[model samples]
Target: MATLRVGRSVARWRVWSTSASVVVTEPDTLAVAREVVDAELSAVDRACSRFRADAELALAERAGRPVTVSPLLAELVGAALAAAERSGGDVDPTLGNDLARLGYDRDIAEVRPDGPAVPPVRRVTSWQDVSLAGRTLTVPPGVRLDLGATAKALTADRCAELVNERLGTGVLVELGGDIATAGPGPAGGWLIHVRDRPADPPATVRVTAGTAMATSSTASRSWRRGGRLLHHVLDPRTGMPSSRVWRSVSVCADRCVIANTHSTAALVRGAGAVTPLARAGVAARLVDNQGQVHVLGGWPS
Candidate 1:
C-alpha cells in the first residue's frame, strides 16, 4: 500500500494551527487546486474557528440571541450538531468554555506547554442547547460552541469535492490527518500512512476514490498543566480530557465527516468503542495507550 506518488502533484501549508495538504492526479491542475483548497479553508476558519474573535461562531456567541448566519456557517453548525446526535453526545460542540478553562483558550501552537493548574470549570453545556433553523442559529446565553470535532473534516470533504468538480481532476485534501478523496484515484488507490505519533507503529492503507479517512489522537495537541497532561479530546459528560484508553483512533468511511465523527467519539468512549464501531460497520484502527493496535470492521491489517 505504499503511496504511488509518481503522477501526483502536492501542495502543503498550515491552517487552523495544523498542517493542510492537497494532492492532485494532474500536475497541471495543482495550482488551481491549491487555490480552491485555500479558499475553502479560509471560509471554514471564518465560519467555525473558536479562537478567532472575528469568526462567525464568536459573533454569534456575542449576539446572545438568534442570529442569521451564512449558509456555510449554518452547514458547519448543523454538521457538528448532527455528529453530536449520532455519537449520543460523545462528540459535543458546546465544550468551548470547557476547553478554554483547561488552558486551551488559544491556538495549540500558542498554548503554553506548561501552565498553571486548570481552574474549576462549570458543567458542560449540551449540544441540544444550541439551535439552528434555516440560516438562523441560536446559542443559549453563556453557552459556547466549539466545532473542532467536524469542521476540519468537513473542510477536507468540501475542498476535495470542489476541486474535482471545478477542475475535472482527481483530488485529495487532508487537513491535519483527516483526508477526503474525489474523482478517480490512482490504479491501486490513494495510499495513506496511519500513525498517531512518530514513535507509534505506522501502517499504510489504500482507499479508492470517494472514500475518506480521519484520525483522532490523545497523543497530539496535548499540554501539561499543574504537572497533569491533558489532550484536546474531552469527554463532554465530564468536561475533562478523555482517559487515555486509546492513544489514537482512525476510521474510514464514505465521507470525512462520518469518519471524524466516529474517530473522535471512539476516543471519548474508550475501550467500549469496539462493539459499536464494528456494529456500525466502520473500518477502524485503534491504538492503545501502551501502543497495542486493534483493528475492527475489516480494517486493513
Candidate 2:
C-alpha cells in the first residue's frame, strides 16, 4: 500500500536517497520541518555513511588511531553500542566488513538486481572492537563501521524533537519503515498501516502523541548470492542472512530508536523473539516464514 498521509495543510516530501518521508501536520511549518528533516538526514549520512569515502565512519576506518568525531557521531555511536548490548549482540554496529564480505558492499536495492553469490562469513569485529571516549572513537585498524541499523532511527527521533520543540507543532517523520511523531497528534492520533510486504494486507492503527513505530522485514532487500538467498539482516555471529524463520517484525515504543532496535533484533532472533519482546514490554507483531502471525506485549490483533 502507498504511504497514507492525513491531516490538513501538511506538506509531504519524500526523500528517496534515504527512503524517508517528511510529514508535518501544520502546513505553515512544513517548510521548516522539511528543512530540518533534510538537514538532519544529510548530516547523519555525512557523519555515519559506510558508503561514503569522506564519511566519518570511513575516516575512522583508516585513521588507525583515535579519531575525533562530531558530537552527533559520538552520540550515535554510543546509541549503537547500547543497542548492541540491549539486543545481546543481535543488532551489531561493527558488522560493516562482515556485510561487505557477503557481497552487500552497496545498497541492498542495487545488490538485489544482480543476484550475485555470497558465501557465509563469520562476524569478525564485535561492537567491543570500536572504542569511544566522548567525541573520540577508535576502530580496529582496517575495520569498517556500519551504523545502518541504528543511525536512521536516531535521525527520526532527533528530527521529531527538533521539529516539535523548535516549531511548536506536531510532526511525523518516517525514515523508510520507521515512523515517529512529536507534539500533539491529530484528533484521533496518527494513523499508520503495517504490513510485512507491499502486497500483504495492512493493519492500520493510531499512535498516541510522542509514540514511534518500526518494522524490520526480510521480505524486502533480499538477493540471491552464490546460489543461496541472502538478505540485508544478518546474524553477527555467523555473518549470514537470518535463517528466515520470521519474515518481519514490527514494534512500537516511546522512542523510534528503541522501536527500531526491537524490530531489527526480532528479525535477527527469529522465533525466539517473542519472549524477549514480551519481557521488554514492547507492543509488537511478528510474521513467520510460513505466514503465521504472532502478537506480543499487548500488540493489537
Candidate with best TM-score: 1
Query: What 10-residue stretch in candidate 1 is worst by lDDT?
Result: 1-10
Tens-digit lDDT track for model 1 on 1-301? 1133544498877878777888898889999999999988888888878888999889999999999999999999999999999999999999998899888999899998987787555574799889999999999998888899999999989999999999999988888899999999977888888876889989988788899999999999999999999999999988989999998999999999999999999999997999889888999999998898899888864
- Clash pairs, candidate 1, are none
> Residue 67, candidate 1: how far off, in angstroms?
0.9
Model 1 TM-score on a 0 to 1 scale? 0.96
Cα deviation of 124 in candidate 2 (Å)? Answer: 3.3
TM-score of each: 0.96, 0.94
Candidate lDDT values, in order: 0.89, 0.81
| CA shift of 224, model 2, Å | 1.4
In model 1, which runs have C-alpha deviations exceeding 4 angstroms? 1-8, 119-124
Q: What is the lDDT for 43 in model 2? A: 90
